[model samples]
Every structure is written in C-alpha cells, then in structure tokens.
Target: MTDFITTELHTARCLLRPWRTEDIPLVPPIADTRAISWNTSLKFPHPYGEEAARTMVSWSQADAGVDKWQFAVFKDGQLIGGCGTIRGEDVHAHTAVVGYWLGVDWWGRGIASEILAALVDYMREETDIEQLTATCFGWNPASRRVLEKAGFRNEGVRKGVVKKWGKTTDLWVYGMLL
Candidate 1:
C-alpha cells in the first residue's frame, strides 16, 4: 500500500487540515444544528454531542493515510466545519465521493465553494483519483451552487432516495473528472 501524507490546504479565508482530538469540543455545537444536519448524510447525527464529536475525531485520525481523507475546515483559526473524500474500492477504485458541511453561522458566505475548490485541487495534485462525485439534497440549492462553482456537473437526481427526519427527499448527484 502507498502511504499518503495529510497536509494542510489554505484558501483565501479558510484552512483545511486533518482533525485533531482538540477539535472535538468545537464540533458538536456546530454540527447539532438542524439546518446543517438536514442537508447532510444521516451518519451526521442531528443531536450531535460530545461523544459523537469524539468518535468523529478518532475516526478521522484513524483514517488518515488511508483512502478516506477528512479535513477540519477552519476559519480565522477556529474549527468551523469539515470536508472529505472517501475513495471507492474494487473496479471503482479511481473514483471518490466528496462531502462537506459548514457551521450554520458560516452559511451564505461562499466558504463552502472556496473549501471545495481547494480540496478538488489538492486531490488532483496529490492522488491518482480519476473522478470525484458529490450528492446534495434536492432542496439544497446552495450546495448545488457550491458544487457547480467547484466545476462539478449535475448528473441526475434519485427520486426520494433518502428518508430522514420523517421526510423523504431526493438526492441530486454531481460529478467532476480530474
């Protein structure tokens, strides 16, 4: 297996780097917001607590140098959110699924777009990945805009593919080739 090194990526306003145990305390409060959780995968707990934050930090640390690349998004030296890519296996090994989320307080500021563009560039330069894919809830136009701004194109939507928080939602798929 090839060993990969995790490094910090900087944008104009944000810093993307590997998560530290110290970051656990900053996660739950930002992640627990309903606005943030509803647009993300179900794995992101809505009632996100200290335990969940600890688990995530631990998992992120363990996944370092592996196929999973998770980064803590920091702005002004404060942990504000995260973004990552999980590589596919077997015949799909060249592909990766990207995901990201920001604190509700940081929404509508183009932070997500900047972070995503930097992440995409980092992946292209550091890895052999061929394609990156992302999905957004159909109702989340902001996320769609972010993906598009980062050069991902809309593929299609899976109708009512996710049933979360007592509601069924469509999943809008987006992809980019590197």
Candidate 2:
C-alpha cells in the first residue's frame, strides 16, 4: 500500500482538509463563479460542475508519488474554498507553487490570508519544501493583497502570460522563503 500524507490543517477561523466525496455538490456553485476563476489558473473551469469537482477530488486523493497537496477550506463547519501546493521536482524540489480561491460570500473577510498563512506554516513544518510561491492575475488586487499580507514578496510580472475572459493579462509572481 502507498503511504499518503492526508492531513488536516486548522486556522483561527477555518479548517483545511482533504476534499470529501460528499463535498462535490458544494464545489460547483462556488468554483464556477467567474470572479473565482478570473484569478485562478486555466485548469479551473469557469462553469465548474459535479464532474469537474469529482475529478478534482479524485485527483487529489490519488497519490502518484509527486508532492502535491490540496485541501478544502472550511469555516464554521462549511466548505468555503480550496487551497493547495504543486511541489516542483528535481532541481526545483525545494519549491512549491501555492494557490487558493474562496466563494464570493467569503470575500473581504481575511480568510484567504489566514488560509495561506496556515498552509505555509504547515508545509514548512511538515514537509521538505523551503519556498512557497504564488501567482496572481494583474487585474486581481484582492489576491495580491492576500499574498502580501501572508508575507509573500512580489517577485516580478510575467507579461501576457495568461489568457482569460478573452483578454491576455500579466501575472504577478510572489514567493515566501521558509
């Protein structure tokens, strides 16, 4: 049997845990929002549905030997969003790229910052990663602020690197050294 690192992380106001099969239904509405997808990677479909959510949950559960960690964000026992890290391999093995998104209802509440801070601390303490990085769309100031407040420093911008909503935009990179 493969040993999997399935763990739950907690913050002052939220719990970050693995996605459950029952959580599939809650994902579609929150993840399908245009506002959430605008700042996320292209892999996050705009019209997220049960199938996508199921695929996500399944993929997250499966261990293919890579150091990828994903968790569903929960507040007051309710699923609010998701966050995770894609750890690099070989020469970049000490680094990982983190990403997160919250439902519209949870915006402006400092939940994102809290989630990142907790996840960063957990990764540093529990894993071998030395650096955590994140990318935010140039048009999304809220995400940028969240990363900043979580102690990530602005690295630089990649011009015209992402095409979303029929427009090509720059991506601001940020990194935190653990």
Candidate 3:
C-alpha cells in the first residue's frame, strides 16, 4: 500500500477538502444529471445515492492511509465536485494520475481548472511526486483544454483504449512534470 498526503487547499473561488458524509446530497445529482460519466472511469451507478456515498467516504478514508488521495471540491461552501491522485507501482510512486469532474451547472466557470491548479500545487509542496498525468476521452476537447491550461502537455492518443458505457473509445494522454 502507498501512503497519501491530505490537506485543505483553497482556490480563488473554491475550497478543496477531504470527502465527508455531508457531500452525499451533492454527489447524486452531479453524477446523474451531467454527461460526466461518459468520459471518465466512474462506475455506471455514479451519483450513487446515499449508500454508495457512505461506502465511498469510508473507502476513501481507508485509501488515504495508503496510496489513494481524494478531495471534495467546494464552491460557495457547497460540494460541487471531486479530485484525486491514484498511486501506481513503487518504481513510479513519485508520479500520480489525476482525475476530476464538476457539476454540470458549474461548467464553463473554471472551477475544474481552479481545483486542478490547487491539486498540482499541493502535490508539489507536500509530496515527493514530480509528475502528474491525466487521460481523457478523445471526444472531450473541453477536458483536454482544462489539462492544457493547467500546464499539462498532450503526449499522444491510444486507439480504442477505453471501454466505457459498453463501447470502445480512444484516449488522449496528458502529462505535467513538476
């Protein structure tokens, strides 16, 4: 198991905190209403209601003591999204994968970018990690742009790389060296 660093991070208009039970109310709608599940690896039952939220919160806390780090993104004092770093093998432990999504209503407001910036800075200051990577569906230009604005460079695309919602899709890889 890998160890993770946890901290409260702030952005110009948002606050990023560890997940809590209070976040359940926001997760379902955000997960269900938005087209968010299409481009990411979230399970189909996302916005997974109260029971799922409880399980996730508990799982996240347990993972934190090892290698996974997840944070709830808040704006106006309300949970609006989430961000996290997932650990890989020991040889690549100094590196992490990044993933996040915001509520559909919050789109185009630069919230994801704000959270990404904070996450990057937090990793640089709090860990030995020197690189962060992200992957997006080939069709998600908006997500590609977010990564670019956050200082990630496009590496390349892998053909038929992901099978989401029962169909195979290509994936674009992005990377940022800290």
TM-score of 1: 0.95
Worst 10 residues of 1 by lDDT: 1-10
In terms of TM-score, the best-performing candidate is: 1
Candidate 3 residues lying further than 4 Å off, grouped into runs, are 1-6, 44-47
User: What's the distance in Å from true for residue 20, model 2?
Assistant: 2.1
- After TM-score superposition, the amount by which residue 25's alpha carbon in candidate 3 deviates from its true location, in angstroms, is 3.4
Which one wins on lDDT? 1
Q: Residue 106 in candidate 2 has what lDDT?
A: 98
- Candidates sorted by TM-score, best first: 1, 2, 3
TM-score, structure 3 vs. true: 0.88
What is the C-alpha local distance difference test score of each model?
A: 0.89, 0.86, 0.79
Candidate 2 lDDT tens digits, 86-161: 8888899999999898999999999999999988887877777899989998889999999999999999999998
Q: Which ten residues in a row have the lowest lDDT in candidate 2?
A: 1-10
lDDT of 1 by residue, 68-170 (tens): 8889999998889999998899998899999999998999999999999999998898888889999999889999999999999999999998888889989
Could you report the Cα RMSD, in angstroms, for every candidate shown?
1.7, 2.3, 2.8
Q: Report the error of model 1 at residue 103, Å.
A: 0.3
* Pairs clashing within candidate 2: none
Considering lDDT, which of the candidate structures 2 and 3 is the better prediction for this target?
A: 2
